[model samples]
Every structure is written in C-alpha cells, then in structure tokens.
Target: MTRWLGASEVAARTKSVMKTTLRSGTGRIHFLLRAWRPISSHTSPVDSSDIISAVSPKTLQKGGDNGNFKQDFMKLKQPRSSVTTVLQSGNSEAQRTSITKLRRVVKKLCKSKRFERALEVLMLMETQNKIRMSPADHALRLELTIKVHGLLKAEEHFNQLPNIASQKASSLLLLHGYVKEQNTEKAEAFMAKLKGLGLVVDPHLYNEMMKLYVATSQNEKVPLVIKDMKQNQILRNVLSYNLWMNACSELYGVGSVELVYEEMLSDKNVQVGWSTLSTLAKVYTQAGLVHKAFAALREAEKKLSSGNRLGYFFLITLYATLNDKEGVLRVWTASKAVSDRPTCANYMCILLCLVKLGDINEAEKIFKEWELDCRNYDIRVSNVLLGAYVRNGLLDQAESLHMHTLERGGTPNYKTWEILMEGCVRSQNLDRGINFLNNDFAGLKCHD
Candidate 1:
C-alpha cells in the first residue's frame, strides 16, 4: 500500500530539487525563453514586420495573430544579453520597443488567457531585463504556475522563494490556489500554518477560507471563521460579511439570514452592495415573502450602476423567480440601454426568465431578436427556447428551431442533443431518441 504525501511533505521534498534545478539552469533561462522563437539560431537583422506582429497595440489589445504569435515574440539580438541592452542599443528603430511596451504585451496576454505565452514574456522581463519581482509579481508567478502546471508545482515555486515563511502575499496566493482547487484538507492545513505565521490577522485570508467553506458545503464552519475574526479583532470587510450571510442563508431560515444582514449594516467598515440585497431577496422569495422580496429587489435596483450589467442580470433573474414578467422586461431593457448590444449571455438570461414565467410567445420574440443580431451562433440560446418548447409540449417548434440552428452554422452541444432527445422521448419517437443518444456519444468520442 502507498501512502499519499500531504501538501507540506510534497513541498519539502520538491523544494531542494527545485532550488538546485533553478540555480544550475539560471544562466540558460534565456534559452528557455527563446524556445518559442520563430527564427533560426543564426543572428539576423530584426524584421520590423515581426516586431509589429508581436507587440503592436492592435495585436496586444485583441490578442490576434497571423498564426505566428506564440512563435514570434521579443526579437532578440543575442542569447547572452538582456532585452534592456537590445532596446537601449543605438538602433533607433529597436529603441521603439521599450520596457513599458513589453509589460503591456504581457498584461494583454494574461487578460486574453494566454498563460503560457504570458509566462514566457514574464520570464523575459525577469531574466532578460533583470527587473525586480514585486510581491504582486510573485503572486502572479504563483498563479501562473498553478494555471500552467498544478498546485504541487506552485508549492515547489513558493518553497524556493527567499524567506518563504514570512512572505504573506505568496502564502495567501498558495492558500487561494488550494481554495480554487477545493482541496479542503490541504486548504485547512495551509490556513492553520498561515495563522501560525501571523498572517491571519488580515480579513482577506479569513474571507477566502469562508468562501472555501461555503463552496464545499461546510456552512457550519462559516460561523467559526467569523468567531476567529472577532477574537483576532479583525475588521470584517464587505466580502467577509457577504460570505457569512450566504452561509446563513443556506444553513438557516430568513430570520437568521436577516440577523446577519442587520449586523452587516451596523458594521461601519463594510458597505452593503447590490449583491447582498439580491442574496437577501432570493431568501425572501424562497420563503414566500413576496412583499419583502420586492422591497429588497427595489433597493437592489437603486444600487445598480449603469455599467454593471451583472447586477442587472441578477435582478432580472430574481424578478423572474418572483413570476414578474413586467419586472423581467424592465430590467432587460435597462441592461440593453447601458450597452452597445446585448450579449448572448444577456439574451440567455432574459430568455430563461421569460421561459420560466411560461411566456412562450414573448420568449420566442426575444429568441428571434437574438437570432437576428447575434454575431456568434450560440446553440445555447437556441437550446433555451428548444427546451422551453419541449417542456410546453410544442415539439414541432423545437424541431423547427433545431433545423434553423443547424442552418445558421450553430453546432449542437451535449445539452442541445439532450434537450432534443427529451422531446423525442416525450413524443414516443424511440428511433430518433436512440439516434440522438448515439450521436451524443459519438460527439463525446470525437471531443476526446
């Protein structure tokens, strides 16, 4: 029988190896950076087109490339020298690519979810430019490590840091990684260790732990986090109170949740937002307190900013849950007024709301409106109406919508097939239902 190594044990074992490996390979780190280079080994004049393609504002903003972005980044003159030297050289054209420009490119890559490419550029910034890594940068590197590799590799990276025990940011970042992975055991142990390191005084750490507990269905542990915060005299932030309220909502009744809200309101340090009100309204709606739910929702609407479509989404959803068609349409119109055009997500939200209210005609009109203006052919939007039609015993409309989706270049996802199969089974069309299930399995195979 093999025993599994705990997080600490794994960290300890990997630390020495990681340090030794890094030390031995520090000189050749630039080579690792250049592995993505599109050019040959021989030194050639830097092509302006290559430079433009890699770090231009348009390229950075949109993260689009002519199938060569991953391959052609940071035109280097030599392997031994820093990018700083190349940029500072007498070549005025090369001087255009400043350190700031490189940093911007890295930021864009990160925003676009190109972590591997972002890591490569970040390595260039560090090894090639000899830039100092700030605390935020350390946290970023740890996050990147978690993304590219896993929690274990991130642990190894953290362990290799100088004064590893004292660095709060890196420690918290690792804790966040554990939380994100939902490894309750390791997260608990690491959090305990964090407290010993005198880093638990910050409410952010406690908030993260509470969020983890809530996510993992450990609602009972959420109050314990609050108790720990009170004992430590840590001032609760908005997020901290919100998590407590959420946990209360899950584990107790509306009254218990309301008490938490009252306490949050009294806390001068924390300002309640539209999110808290929405959560409260959800609880109220569930409890059949229509008047109270409506009151909370009204307050939540007032708190909404024009640019914050998320609040509108939540509001629209809750209004639908309350069976208010007028409220749903009102919020949907508000959302579109603030933006250039409604996103597929926005259409889905309202479509779901209308469908839930049993307003098939209104939902169909909304679906048609989406079908006309949607840049991307999202089968999900069509599937919402398709599922609605099937649930309402309108199998013909569902079939017609399915055909229309196929004509519009929309590919059927698993949910699409499942919805259609459900309709087929309801109509007693066993042959087509069998075909759908087979097709779904085939799709899975092709995906794999």
Candidate 2:
C-alpha cells in the first residue's frame, strides 16, 4: 500500500519550496501563524481531525514532481550569474497580459467566497512571474481563510507579506479574529504589537471587544477597556456609551447604571437619547428600584415627546407599576391601539396584574383585540409574564402566550428558557421538554 502523506507533510513540502525563493517568507509565516491563535483557541479535549483539516493542502500546490524539484533545488543551491537572458528571447508583454488576466480572475474570486481559488490564482501568478503579495492582499487572504476554514491555516499565507503601514489596520482585524474565541490575553498581546507598530487601539476596537466580553458575562473587564478608550482619546459613540453603561449595570447594579446615566447626561458633545434611557430604565426595574426606574421613565418620556418615541414601552412600565390606569389607557387610546403600541415590561406587568385581579375577560380582550399592542419589542417581558403564568398553573394561557411570543418575532432568551424548562418539568410537558432540550436557541438570529 502506498502511504499517503499527512496534510502537514504536504503543506511543509509546498511551503519549503516557496520559502526557498523568498527572503523574508519564514518571518512572515511565523507572524501570521501566531496571529491565528486567537480564534482557533481550543483548550479542551483536543481534536485531531480539526488539526488535520486546518493544515490541509489548500494553501499549497505542486511546483514540480519530486524528481524534477530535487534537480531544480540542486541548480538553485548555487548562486547563478546575474543575466537577463529571458528578456532577450521572450515576449515581455505576454507575461504582463497573463498577469493582468490573473489579477482580474483573482479579484473576482475574492468577491466570491472561493478563498482557496483566489489564493491559487495569486500563487499561479507568482509562479509565472514572481508576484509580491502586498499586506492588504495577504490580510484579505488571511481573513477569507479564517472565515471559511477556521484560523488554523490563515497564518501560512499571512506571514509571506512584508509588514508595512498599509498592513497595520488589516493585521489588527486578523488579530481580532484570532482572539475571536474570547481569548483576552492573546488579543491584548496582538493589540500591543499594533501599538509597537505605532497604531493606537481605537475605542471602536475596544468596544468590539467589550461586546465579546459582555456576551460572556466578563463584565469586570469593561473598566480596563474604558481606560484604554480614554487614553486613546477615542470619542465614545452612543453604542459604546450603551455598552459601558450595560457593563456597569451588570456589575454594580442600579448604582453603576445611574452613574452611566449621569455620565451620558453630562456629555454635551454626546446625545443621550432613547436607547440610553431605555437601558437604564430596564436596569432600574430589574434591580427593584422602582422610583429610580420611574425617574428614568420620565427622562425617556421628556426626550421622546420631541419626536423620538422609542422609550414609550419603558414609560408604560412605570405607569403600570403605579397603577395609573388613566396614564396607561391614554397612551394606548392615543395610538388608536391598533397599529402601534409599546410592548415592554410595563405592558407585561399590566397584563400580569390584570390577570391577578381575576380580570381574565379584559386580559383576553387585550390579547385578542389589541393585537398590535404587542408591537416590535424586546422578548424578555413576554418570557417573564409567561413565567408568572407557569407558576400559577395557568396552562392554557401560558401555552397560547408562548406560541404568540414565538409568532411575534420573539426568540426566548436564557431566562425565558429556564422558566420554560422548569414549567416543562413541573407540568410534565414531555414533548415540549424533549424539543426544548434539543433546540438550538442560540442560533436563532434576530429578525427584528
């Protein structure tokens, strides 16, 4: 039986032949490989299959047969006299035309998702007439490689390009991908390398990282990034302010959330509108600070009155809490209660309280008649109210509500999920339980 070489063997063979022709190839390859460590981070039960595929032969190809390759190597081992004999007989314009055609083909390939094909074109162009891979070109190749096949093989191509000013930004993005698996330390090290190159880490980069950390609930990391933002003189955009505020709320509860509110409010250069108030209002309510929550609710309402009404849902909660039936009814009626209505915690609270008072008739009427009251809103409240129904053994209502929640562009969050899982256990909804257990809730993209 003929033994087939492993992927690494193929890559090594191809890389070896290619490296021999280029002076700085080894250094470039090393830098690229180190950069890919971020996104390919897997520390658990090591997977050999992934390794094999990562080191696959896509980035390399044959220059010649083994026998011919050895003969060419023997010839190349000695320095030849500097002669331009090819130009004396060959059509130079033909070579240029061929290279131009390859460029067009490669450009189109880049637009499509065929990364390996594009790399093939580049390598082929290089083989015909040594094409220098610019930093931008290398970075593009690295990005596509990682996006299509994972981070394993991206570095191989990345390292072949010389480090230049143009490569700086693209390099950071590649490094960002490396740390995409939430590897903070490695990402920071890569970020520092950019600093060594005289590129300051901007607030947007920090914000992007902050989002990743927040998703993993590493809320404590928010402060350090905030410091980086300040040092870089990167102005905080609305989203950055929102993210920092969110981090504060997660850690210090309402106190930190309020502090963010104060910070946003103090910035005359910045516009602290609906989203800021919306976030703070939600945090205050969740932290059980009804008074402070209502204060945020009022702040939202004032700003919204001048044509931005995104915070209408938050206001409904404050009104619902105080049992201000008129305030709730007034807003509901003013909108004709048909096409537009705010559906957040406040509305859900009203529904829950109405049910608690044995006013099932009115609640059902709202569910059936005031259908648009469940406008495009966050799904958390629906899940929360559903939890209340589950506790009280309101089976029929919970079932209908759950179905409606799904229908109205609401994907269940972890909180909603835990409640459903518990209900499934308590009510013994076996089919629902099995289905829920097997469901890929996290994969549900936001349609809203």
Candidate 3:
C-alpha cells in the first residue's frame, strides 16, 4: 500500500534536500530523483498525478480545465473587468476550479506579453478563491506585477506577502527584475541577502547575477560568478557556460574564449548546441581568425536542428560578415529545404544578406520570388531593395521601385519615407525632399 504526502510535507522535504544537495557535489540526476521522495522510509510514495486522477479529474486537467479555458481567455478583450465578472457569473464549475488551472491561465497570458490581463487573472484567483497561494504562485504574480506596473510596485506587492519573501522563487524573481532594470546596487544587495538566507542554491540565481554583470559592462565579475557556482557545488547549465564564454571573449580575447569552450565541451552534463558553436564563430570572426571562424561555422551547421529558421539566419549573416558569398548562398538554399514556403522575415533576412554582399542582381531575383509567392503586398520587403538602390546611387531605380510599390497597394512606412528622403538629400533635390516631408507624407522628418 502507498500513502500520499501532504503538500507542505513534500515542500519541506524538497527544500531540505535541495539545500543538502547544494552543499554536496551530488549528481544532478541523483539530486532530482531524491528531491521529491516521501518522508516515510517504509511506505511507497504515491505520484501527484495519481492523486489528481483519484480526487476530481473535472476540477483540473493538468493545470487547466482543458483547452477551452485558454481559448475563452484569449477572446477576452477587456480581461481586467471581464475576467472576474465572467468567471464569477454564477458558473459553479469555474468557481470550483483549482488554483493550478487559474495559475496556468495567468502564465499563458504572461507569455504573450499580456501582463495586464495576466495580473488581473492572478488577482481574481487569489481574491475569489479559498485556495492557498504557494511561493511559486507569489513569484509569478511578482513577475507579472513588474511587467504591468514597475519594480517599485512589484516590491510593494512582494513586501505585503511576507511569507514569500523568504522563498527561493519570489526572491529570484525580484533579483531577475533588478537585473532586468540593470540596478546594480539593489541587485548586489538583494543577492547578498538571498545568499545569507541560503536561497541561492540554484545555478539560475548565479546566472541572473552573471547576466546583470554582463549587461552593465562589468565583464570582469562574470568569472567570479562561475567561481561562486563552483564553491556552492551548483551544477552550471548551458547558459552559465555561454555567458562566461561571452564575457571571456569581450575581456580576454579569442584564446580565452576557446579555453572556456573547451571546458564546456568536457563537462558531461551540458550538451553543446548550435548557438554555442555560432557564438564561437562570432568570437573568431571578431578576432579576424577567418579560417577558425569558417571551421566553427561548419561545426555549427552540423549542430543545427531541423527546421530551425533562426539558426540558418545566424549562419547566413555570419557567412556574409566573413565575406563568404558562397557560404551565404549555400545556407540560404539549405534554409529553403526546411520550410515549404519561407516566411517574409526569412525573405527579408536573405535579401539583407545578399544586399550586404553587393549582389544586387541576386537580391532582385529574390525580390521577384517574394513578389510571386507573397499573398499580401509588404512595403517593408520593397524597402530592402529600395534602400539598396539609394545606397548604391541608383536614384532612378529607387524612384522606379517606390512607384512600383505604390502601384501594388503597398503602403509606405516611416522607414520607406526616410530612405527616399535620404536619396533626395544625396541627389541634391531639396524641393522633392520638402514635398516628401510636407505634402507626400505628413509628419515625415527630413534626414540630415
């Protein structure tokens, strides 16, 4: 027979185990398996999923009332007022819904930058329900509050919740907010407080501190963060290694960066990904090691996952930076194989790379291809070729392209106007520039 542990009992044991693991050089796999074990030595532990299944399946299905709740939440235009009214409008099902379901909804909204709505949902869940708010929940609300309001308001909210201040999650969120604002004094002070409380057991906390150092151009402090992680026996993740390598590149040059890379490769836990290789290539390119950069890029290509558009974009841009036109074309061709039809952004990326390489003829061919495949006329796409013409002193071609875009129902944005204004000034056409600024496009500023 198995017995289920109370939530509080499980949480206490987990926290204690985490602290113990932090002090020891325990394997991450071993630590993770031990972290959630039951307090009892004899009885087997019942899984939380099984408990949820036995209790009430309809109340929540894996942190939600299923997909319908998310769809309904998304349809809410005025979530602040509507969320509470809709949820509490004599709907017994919603009224009886679990906090986990509500928290998941809040997270979904937050992920989409709908912080105002997310905050509202979280507030409603707390005020309307009898369910207890955990430390993680408090942390989430802190993050949302920071996004919706600011750090001051978020701190006020955090201070009001005295119980959560001691928890790792909320404190980490506050530190993250401090880091995001680049508040060095507050971040360092708060970090010291967290360390004193023994809440800095996780590598994520150290990563956040390292990120703050890097962001504020305090690159020398990054290695110190790695040292702290080592002292604390916290296993460093990929982000940790990446940030350390970047700081090394900026402060110590390519050789030091390569040394960091070598250390990361030897680490049994961290899987070396494409982005890491790309970073190496970037560092090599910046140091003027063309052969080394090419070698790194080739390795990066093999590391790239299937259908990764962003990875191809990085490779294409790097190849262009290295003036390897063949490499750029090759990556672009490979990129097309990943998708049935490339996105407008993909077309734009390739166009920019081709234009940078001074392959205007190739760019023109791509622009035509985009024209044929495009469902909607995108003015931004035309601006790429138009800007290329203006930059190359082809004022006539620029004008023709502008007129062509106008005829195709493409509306000119501020960028398109700015390009034309720049072209006019370069060609000594003051009257045309004035006309563009005044009559043609209202509120268009003349470029100097």
Model 3 Cα displacement at 277 (Å)?
1.3
Candidate 2 lDDT, tens digit per residue, 1-448?
2222233442333343233324345566778677443232122333444332211121112222334332332232110110111112245554344334445545665676545555544443333334454556556656766766676566554555456654564666666675578777666776676667766545656676787778778989887888777887777777888898889887887777777768877877689876688677778777887787767766765566534333554455456665655555555444343344444644565566555544555555655553565555456656656776767767556766765665565555567657766776777656666555444232222211
Off by over 4 Å in 2: 1-143, 154-180, 215-218, 250-257, 301-448
Off by over 4 Å in 1: 1-97, 124-129, 163-166, 432-448
Per-residue lDDT of model 3, residues 316-404, tens digit only: 99999998889999988887767557788889988999999999999999999999999988778999999999999888788778767
- For each candidate in turn, the TM-score is 0.76, 0.46, 0.75
**Pairs of residues at least 3 apart in sequence or in different chains that clash in candidate 3:** none
Better of 1 and 3 by lDDT: 3
Clashes of 3: 0
Model 3 scores a C-alpha lDDT of: 0.75
- Put down candidate 1 lDDT per residue, 1-448, tens digits, no spaces: 1222233443343344334434546646666687644422223444444333333443333333433333344333222133434344554444444444555556666888867766655555555343556666667777787888789988887777656433677887788888988899998998887787677768988888998999999999999999989988999987887788889888888889999999999989888889989988998998899999999998998888887688899999999999899999988887875755778888998999999999999998998899889898888899899999889888778767776776677766678767867876787767656654553445333432
